[model samples]
Target: MKRTIRLAASIAGLAGTIVLAGPPTTIINFDTYPDGSAVQPTDAFTTQYSTVGVEFNGPGPSGNSCSISPPNHAYAKRIVASFVDPCTGVASVTSYAGTAQDSCWVPGEGIDMFAYDRDGNQIGHEFNAGGGHFTAFSFPQPVIARLDMYCILQGIDNLAFIAPVPVLRGDLNCDGAVTSSDVGPFVLALIDPSGYAGAFPSCDIRHADMNCDRRVDGLDIQGYIDAIFPP
Candidate 1:
């Protein structure tokens, strides 16, 4: 659960705090909507920040210091590192720009969050795991009522933590992966007929997708056979 705390942060002497860039909102605290799917609206957690308070507190950008203090009134999905404009409700963002500090994911990391208009045109994106937070993107010049969010996190152990929690959040078959192959075809059929390939509990072979194609097909079967062969 994304439980929020509001405790005063206990910082030891000489703790460095430097300005950084980022996003600062956490959402879907206790639901199964990693892609914000079926993400219901809850009370808004607002912070009055500005370009004046943009700062970072970690070894470097992309640092895993996601935390908040007085952890009661609200909670941050990860520690606040920085902000885009720091004043406006964020619309665009990035994380861990090139610097001396080496990236944990080699050439660097980009846990991307994509926002799109209803027409499926990308309006904005945030690198570095939504800038270690989330952005509020609106479609059609910020007037459209709906803007969809989808994300990809690399080297995020938090993803591992959330995986077993169940819910639609565990849908690894997203990205049409569940529909990338025969299994996807099956899901399409399930969506259409509801009693076809998925009629049997044992037939939900979505995971049978071995090529990351998100399907159960001849390729997957061949992959399985490949695994059994001598290297």
Candidate 2:
């Protein structure tokens, strides 16, 4: 049977927010398993990316490597999942970001944030142009979220990608547009108490964390309208 290495990330925050990723940074580098486990069904995952950074390098050297470019849906909040078969821990994996600019407009406006792992894949996102959201992720192993980064380009042709802005919370309903329906979950929780045992009555944060504060409250309810139809 093909064994499954469940690569994943541990988030610093929940729903609609960028989790704090700093200090105690980790870079995966290994030719063998720390436990002497046989090499996995995949290539070794290693990198120089510190805890301060998350996205792994692409198929080349630091000074020059190709990566996913912006304007693609991936840049706007899409998830990328890849599989690793050995079930061995992930020190790092390979992938790159913001290397192309065919439709370059806002130069230096790109970001890549790696999220948790689940079954056989390094599950996360590649914010090619700017920020978006991490959604529908499930973790099977301890994972670290990283802010994929790179050095500041020093020439006129040089560029530093601008990170993505997390998706607005009021779009909680995720109906392709924010609306009153987005407020339904929070209202149910706020208006009814006897139906839930979870911290928030709605249980699903994406629905209630309107302010993306990691909590549900009147402020979030207020956050809803403000974001859907902001001033």
Per-prediction TM-score, please? 0.21, 0.28
User: In candidate 1, what are the lDDT values of residues 1-231, reduced to their tens digit?
Assistant: 223222223232213232122323232222223334331234332222212222222211132333211111122233332332222222223321211111223234344444333255655555543233323332223222122222133322221100011112112233322223344444443354345344444333343444544444555555444433424
- What local lDDT does model 2 show for residue 76? 19
Native-referenced Cα lDDT, model 2: 0.33
TM-score of 2: 0.28
Candidate 2: worst 10 consecutive residues by lDDT?
Answer: 154-163
**lDDT of each residue in 160-227, candidate 2, tens digit only:** 12222233344443454667665664465555533322534323344445543444567666666676
* Top-TM-score structure, candidate number: 2
lDDT computed for candidate 1: 0.30
RMSD of each: 19.3, 19.4
lDDT of 1 at 42: 49
The candidate maximizing lDDT is: 2
